[model samples]
Target chain A: MKHYNIYVTSKPVIYDPAGRASENTLAKLGFSGIERLRIGKFIEMQCADDVSLESIKQMCDQLLANPVLEDFRIEIVD
Target chain B: MSDFRFGIVVFPGTNCEQDVAHAVRWLGHQAEYIWHQDTTVSQFDALVLPGGSSYGNYLRPGALAAASPIIAAISEYAAQGKPVLGISNGFQILTEAGLLPGALQQNASLTHICETLDFYVEKTVCQWLQLASGTMISLPVSHGFGSYYADAATLIQMESNGQIVLRDTQARIAAVCNEQGNVFGMMPHPERACEVLAANHPAGAGGTVFSTIVKHLEVVR
Candidate 1:
């Protein structure tokens, strides 16, 4: 069995409203000079050892993340 | 009277199918429910993906529903140049399935907003809008994620293709269609706005767009 971790974030062109709201809360909590903040998703899954990176990429493109508004990075768990 | 038949696609988490069917019947049209597991949508004169949080909207508003079997059927239905309307969450599903351009993101305020909004018609090429440019229509918009987002390049292409059909006072995209103009997706709920006599008109502005699409299909088919 293999473990995979996927990180999904909104593309720079897409606005992060949730992230901005969080930043505002942080500022009110006295955290100053915070340049930027973003909110993203992290997903983990178990796959057979035979699954290739290309197959995982296809999954990401097909359903894991929307390519139009979000970008994703995948990591293999050792 | 043109008796058009509409199919309201229903996923497990859908709550608007009954309302949509009622609205269709009110417009003197026939309507039936099409489950997400079903594979065909060709039997109806037109298809409507109604408002609701399909699949609980946990994995993104329309992410799970877009991969359902019926969406594939919808893709084929649209390819044949038939009319398809997606309202509220349906609009998110359409973008997820690649039926329409742009993605519906979280609102700029990062909060859920449920209220009636004024929508302005921009281009008439969608035809189902049946309204001239500069016309305003009021409909109920209810959603937590209703911001329309597209890369600058895609926006330029959509502009060139004449796919933008409607916008709000703030100039946010209220509705859009496919390049071929056969499908439309919007974040407003027309069904919720239908038949409000208290609002002065019996059918209301939302009903106008809803009935217009069915009537338009009736004329062509």
Candidate 2:
């Protein structure tokens, strides 16, 4: 079996409502100077060694995530 | 004084019957509760599948509930263009029942979502959403599985055919209508709004959804 490290991140321009709400609350609490905030996800999936990198990429594109709002990177570890 | 007859299907774990029933009744219509075990589609003008875990959220959110006898009758009714509105988990059941297309997966962050989501109208042709294009409505969203997934061709068709009804400002879809456009399944709980009661109206302003359906039925009736 092969192990892959997947890093999923929202688009730079996509608004993170959860983070925005927190930033507002934080500022109201007197914690100022908070610049930018972005939230992403990390996923680790094990696939068969015979699974080509290209096929895994397709899986990530179709079922694993939504490309319109999210972008992902995959790297083979060990 | 027989007004329009409506029915809300109740599965083992559903909890939104009263909300939906209130919406239906408030519109000068009638709503009856239909148990999941019954295959009969009660004499109703429309059917609502409210949100909640059915069958303990096994195999998938709505996988089991879709196979219930009531669901079988719902499918038949939907084929005849009787309105079928599925909210949240009910949406999951519509997909599982094959009444609607696409599958709902876990959130992108793999976390449960419980927040107010803004949904804008994408199709004016839809009976339930006859509002102007770009009308925004606030609705509560509470679920772990609400990510919509479909093949490339189906997605393309949905967009071209006006089946994609409600989307967020950023264009991430929040809801979709079936091919016929009479069957709608959405992740947001519009019935959860405090607008269900006159005293708590502002907080529950989501009653517009029920009102919209009533208007459509009136036009047809």
Candidate 3:
């Protein structure tokens, strides 16, 4: 089985409200010099060796991630 | 009491199907609950995807539910220009299903905003709302992800196409219709406001929204 990692996040134009609120909370905790914080989803899945990255990408594009609100990246470990 | 039937699609986590059914029945139409797994929606004259954290709202609200079997059936239903209304989470599902343009993101405040606010009905391609243009009505919005997000170009196009249906008092997009105008999606709970027992209903501005749909069906039928 091949393991893959997918990172999904809101497009830059779409503000990550929860991330912004968390950043605010961290600031309240006295953390300083933080540049930015954004919340996103990470998915890990396993497929058969014959499964192609193209299929995985298709899955992400069609269902795993919503193209309208988010962008996703797929990664596989050597 | 009308023979027109409105099917309320209920995803597993959907919690507002009953409210929508009640409102439809109150307006004197037959209301039925159709499960997400159901493959056919042909019998219903109108379709409604009610609110609630469908599929537990995991992987983003309405994501899973949007991919369910019922959405595909309803897509065809909407193509026939049948009236389809999606409220709150239902709106999320519809957008996700590509029945409507734009996506609903988490509220900018990052909390579930539950409040009754005034929304201005816009003259648009929407068939569900028969109220006069610019009419102000009170409706309750309760959602953790109710803020609407669409790129500038798309927003402009929707505005010009008369697809933008309802806006908040501050002019933020609260509801929208497809280019065809048969499908409507909004973040507010009009069912909650269409109470027959409430003093405002039938007389209040937003209270007549459901009745308007009932009337529309009468004409279309």
Q: Is candidate 1 or candidate 2 better by lDDT?
A: 1
Q: Which parts of model 2 are misplaced by more than 4 Å?
A: A1-78, B194-205
Which regions of candidate 3 deviate over 4 angstroms? B196-206
* CA-based DockQ, model 2: 0.04
Of 1 and 3, the candidate ahead on DockQ is 1
Looking at model 1, the pairs that clash are none
State what share of the real interface contacts each candidate retains. 0.94, 0.00, 0.76
- Give the deviation of candidate 2 from the true structure as CA RMSD: 7.9
True contacts kept of 2: 0.00
Q: Judge the docking of candidate 1 as incorrect, acceptable, medium or high.
A: high
| Candidate DockQ scores, in order | 0.89, 0.04, 0.80
lDDT of 1 by residue, B1-221 (tens): 58888899998888889988988888788999988999978789889998889989977999999999888789998998998999888999999999998888888887799878788987656756855457888877889998888888888988787788889998889889888888999888888778865254335777777667866766786
Worst-scoring 10-residue span by lDDT in model 2 chain A: A61-70
What's the best-to-worst order under lDDT?
A: 3, 1, 2
Q: Predictions ranked by TM-score, top down?
A: 1, 3, 2
Docking class of 2: incorrect
The runs of at least 3 residues in candidate 1 whose Cα sits more than 4 Å from the true structure, single-residue gaps closed, are B197-203
Clashing pairs for model 2 are B193-B204, B194-B204, B195-B204
* Estimated TM-score for each candidate: 0.95, 0.70, 0.95
Clashing pairs in 3: none
